[model samples]
Target: MGLFPRYKRAARVAGAAILAALLAGCSGLGSKAPPPTYELMAVQSFPRGVGPIRGQLIVAEPSALALLDSDRIMVRLANGQTEQLANAQWEDRLPKLLQARIIQSFENGRRLRAVGKPGDRLVADYQLLIDVRAFQISADSNTADIEIAAKIVGDRSGRIRAARVFKVSVQTDSTEGPAAVAALNDAFNRAVVQLVLWTTRVI
Candidate 1:
């Protein structure tokens, strides 16, 4: 028993919380609430009458580096340090979510003869390959950064037709769970729109 018994108790509680957080990553089983989850949606409307390009297209699962590959919502601190959004996460893996929404977007375009995933076992005329370059929000500012690279290749000939990279920035203003996800989804929709439009012209 020390003279400052209450101070000792507070220190012990704080230490325990830190330990729990370390073990559980950002979302701990401590008194704090569970982290919220977010998801990206496909753009509903695409340019119709896109000059009658017809082909079966398969969208591959996008490739991303370790930092942008996880379900965690990524953020870069003001000091250029990287961390996740402590209160939010993606509903699914980033790549999986991107692939699904992209497929949906192609279907929304309604110009393709067909759109399938690699697992669909369909003979496709062209394949749309995507790579995730950067997708993160800066904590210093409420701006989200997104960069994507894409390649269109002939499935039968195995020849590359076209390739391009896309970059988009969006100011979310609301930092936490409320508006951060909305901002990210907006950026994704816009970027994917371009990717779709470019693929239409190339293929």
Candidate 2:
């Protein structure tokens, strides 16, 4: 009877040890660290041009496809498939991010008297509508491509005064997160500059 009790206690101790090890393994598996986050570099300024618009201009949030609307950094594979970078993300949704940057670009140019978004309560003279056609990095060639279509509508007339599509492709040395994002930023800046200049000229 003494031996039996001793054996029972030993078996219980072994079972507890096994349970602890299993719990530790499960914890380790669950504790996987997330990937790092990245943000699009904002445009500092565009070249100043003659002040073309003297009234408030409202910038709308650009529209994009479901895949392009997310914070994921997109990549186009050689096989023509689209995928996002592993463990990397954008600071904001693509449309919102671009809208803020476009407003900043106009501000930097100093060509407009005022610029704002939809809810700013600004009595706008014109509205800038944008559609994001392509904003992604090409994994096969290691390049960044940005395409945006812009339209300026007269607030009073409610008619589109001008429309244009701006496209830019910049070669990157690597498809890695940092390099690719840098390239995308450069391309975006170029596109924003063009859009700002064109909008000012037409509106």
Candidate 3:
């Protein structure tokens, strides 16, 4: 009878341990949550009066807007440390981002017949080729510096129509990454506004 009592107590303890383990397993099975997702922001502006530049193709780097490289050196937090932004998506890659910004600025200017990528079959009168050298927010990040070298070539004549390098800096107090992007965008906007005005006169 004494040995029977000890055996019963041992069985009870083992049963309790198994029940606790099962409950823990069930909790674990139900604990997972979905990962966060981000939707890219579409290029903003009106398409009204906007069409392919009469006879030109605007080609931009496809993956520039990605955290990935975009030929243009983007300003990043410098200390050999990186922090991922929560769930924000950008409109285009580096070159494409810059191209779209340029396109939109021109759209706002209400100039040009058509402005688009380079693959169309139409005979372009002028082609604007761009190489973005640096678009960076400085160490203080209070200002954004943008430098771009571009050439406008007459398609049929194959002559360098208008070639100019643009460098512009816009002041801002924003220290955030998105704010830095916005400042850079603003600088680009002003520079393109000037370039388009000049181009409209020349062409």
For candidate 2, write residues 1-203 as lDDT tens digits: 67999999999999999999999999999997867888776568766566444667999999999999988889999999999987788888989998887888788778878999999988899999999999999988889999988889987789998889999999999887788888999999888878877777776
Off by over 4 Å in 3: 1-68, 71-73, 76-89
RMSD of each: 9.4, 4.2, 8.3
Q: What range of 10 consecutive residues in model 3 has the weakest lDDT sum?
A: 34-43
| Highest TM-score against the true fold, candidate | 2
The TM-scores of all predictions, comma-separated, are 0.81, 0.84, 0.59
Ranking of all candidate structures by their lDDT, best first? 1, 2, 3
Candidate models: Cα lDDT each: 0.87, 0.87, 0.59
Pick by TM-score: 1 or 3, better one: 1
Can you tell me which runs of candidate 2 are displaced by over 4 Å?
A: 1-28, 51-53
lDDT of 3 by residue, 21-128 (tens): 999999999986632332222234433434434334453333222444433234545563333432333443456666655666655555566665566664667777
lDDT: which is higher, 1 or 3? 1
Q: Which ten residues in a row have the lowest lDDT in candidate 1?
A: 25-34
lDDT of 3 at 68: 40
